[model samples]
Target: MAKSNILARTGNEAMAEAMRQVNPDVVAAYPITPATEIVQIFASFVADGLVDTEFVPVESEHSAMSACIGAASAGGRVMTGTSSQGLALMAEMLYIAAGLRLPIVLSDVNRALSSPINIHCDHSDTMMVRDSGWIQIFSENAQEAYDNMVQAVKIAEAVKLPVVVTTDGFIISHGMERIEILDDAEVKKFIGDYKPEHYLLNFEKPITVGALDLTDYYFEHKRQEIEAMKASTPVIIAVGSEFGKKTGRSYGLFEKYKMEDAEAVMIAMGSTAGTAKVKIDELRAKGLKAGLLKPRVFRPFPKEEIADALKGAKAVAVMDRSDSMNAQEGPLCLEVKAALYDKAANKPVLNYVYGLGGREIKPEDIGTVFDDLFEASKGKEKPGVSYLGVRE
Candidate 1:
């Protein structure tokens, strides 16, 4: 029941310390910017016996995830970290781990997907793997990053599904902030030892893993994974509540700020939502009704909650950090619309795209955005998506 204080650290370091406190049996990874430090810190802990963890020095990201799949199949409490192309390299293995119901806990420091080779923050890296059957949760800060890493393990282990704790690349990964870290004993007790129902290394069981599935059972195997993902929603909220009781920090699938009696709202994800929240506060202080609905759980999208949150508003602005490249709508916006479809008299939705390739988004800009949308709601203007702080 003791709380510990640590000096301000980049979110990556806090995540590493949290992983160690959770005490995974195996920690295997190769260095990649933003996320490499997480594994390095744990590797040191393993080397110094600070943690009873096995260190696997894999040559590439592909092998990093492969190592996780192997350890997880054997029922070892396993963890790993990666970013951008590293995640893409481990892309194929992601589904493999999930398909086997490995219950692996991974952290993806969100980065821009490559082609022109962007190394900054965005959702493309993690978004690309959204359909890989992993329960994904996006964190807004270092504390949430640390907390979610621990909770991710609990969620994954509970549902027998793989889970990912994601945060913006440079936003949290590189920025330093003082964080209250949970004690190791509590982590051990909270996460508990991962007890697999079917461990591959169990000689008594001798169960087959990753076996070739014919059409007869292929759908069944995949269906179970999907079912596991759906089951994770309740588990995610439960674990988050436990952490809140322990640390006094509460988070939800979708969190709204200043939405009450507001005529307009901005729904977004990642760190920008926090920025928007602050601006919303300032606007509300000036007597403007502006609210923000920040989606913490990106996968298995929180449809019912979102619809209810934006129900009475005249307008809702959905901000996405990454574009669909050429899609009709940004990923989050399109999903929000679908989440609201079939509802009666919903608000007009505006889809805005920003922060691609690490474009800076300031809070004052959000205020201007609200002014624009508020006017549009009055029939004196029009609502449409525009890049905030993007060069023409």
Candidate 2:
């Protein structure tokens, strides 16, 4: 393993540190709560000459992304950071960026969407863009957040698509944790130099991008985009494997904690997975066959791997931190159910929407979900949607 520098830092700071190490050609960003520190710190790097990057302070998140798209189209390594409303404002540009196949890296600090006007940790922001063709990776803590940020650049460049490295807003963003960072030279060597095959600025091969494909070509273009998205799966795995080899930390599509022969399991993403791990340990010590499955990669869904992992579990509970507002189960739950639809096991699965607007989801709360899963396994109750840590 490569020698690493151990440091204590918040998720945003960690992400910014990784950005500094990568030293992209351009960074365009706007400040928002929780996610502000990431770009703010990076801007300081730009000003101090720590990195030779052009920092563009845009008026809004839309302009920030638009600038990044332009920079990326012109054959530059570009990145940015945003959260909640910032991401919502850049919704249209997100699809455009992905469709154009620009390898832009975005650090998305997860926060709840408005209406009640709350700014705290939740998966709503990312859930809204789940289908926008960006490779989404959820980090459980600062270490993972930092590691994912570095890996994202490599993954995006390899797939010629955008990548979103997400962490819970105030939960992981502001919370300090001990993390290991790769040496600056090592990171640069690993990321290598980005050389695009086709770009707007390539004088030898001039090409028009984002052209309006009205009828016959639009569908084919969309199909090509889907193929690119699917192609990202192997690239993600390859990058993650290479990262693990350099560092001692290995990552996969999802993490299975003590899932071997587990009769009851809990599936979740983001910071809550950390809490679930604690609950799983507690239940395991008490001789309960409990486990936790935390998905690091949300896009491309990892359907087959997830199905195979949960095959032996008699019951499963999918914990979603954001509600879809469809009056039904949340995004993660729906995907999990669909993945297991034709499986022979046909195990019972439940959905619990919790931790919205930064509500505390404690270890005890997770234990309760596992208890419910065990009960459902015994046919004591049918699997369904419910709320945790919420007032009815």
| Candidate number achieving the greatest lDDT relative to the actual structure | 2
> Can you give the lDDT of residue 304 in candidate 1?
81
Stretches off by above 4 angstroms in model 1 are 1-6, 380-383
For all the candidates, what are their Cα RMSDs to the real structure? 1.5, 0.9
Model 1 lDDT per residue over 261-370, tens place: 88889987878888998898888899888888889998767888888888878888888888887756788888889888857655677888888878788997788778
Candidate 2's residue-wise lDDT over 1-392, tens digit each?
Answer: 89999999999999999999999999999999989999999999999999999999999999999999999999999999999999999999999999998999999999999977899999999999999989999999999999999999999999888999999998999999999999999999999999999988899999998888999799898899899988888888888899999998888898999999899999999999999888888898999999989999998789888988998999999999899999999999999998899565587899999999999999999988988998999988755998999987
Backbone clash pairs for candidate 1 read none
> For candidate 1, what is the lDDT?
0.85
Model 1, residue 21: distance off in Å is: 0.3
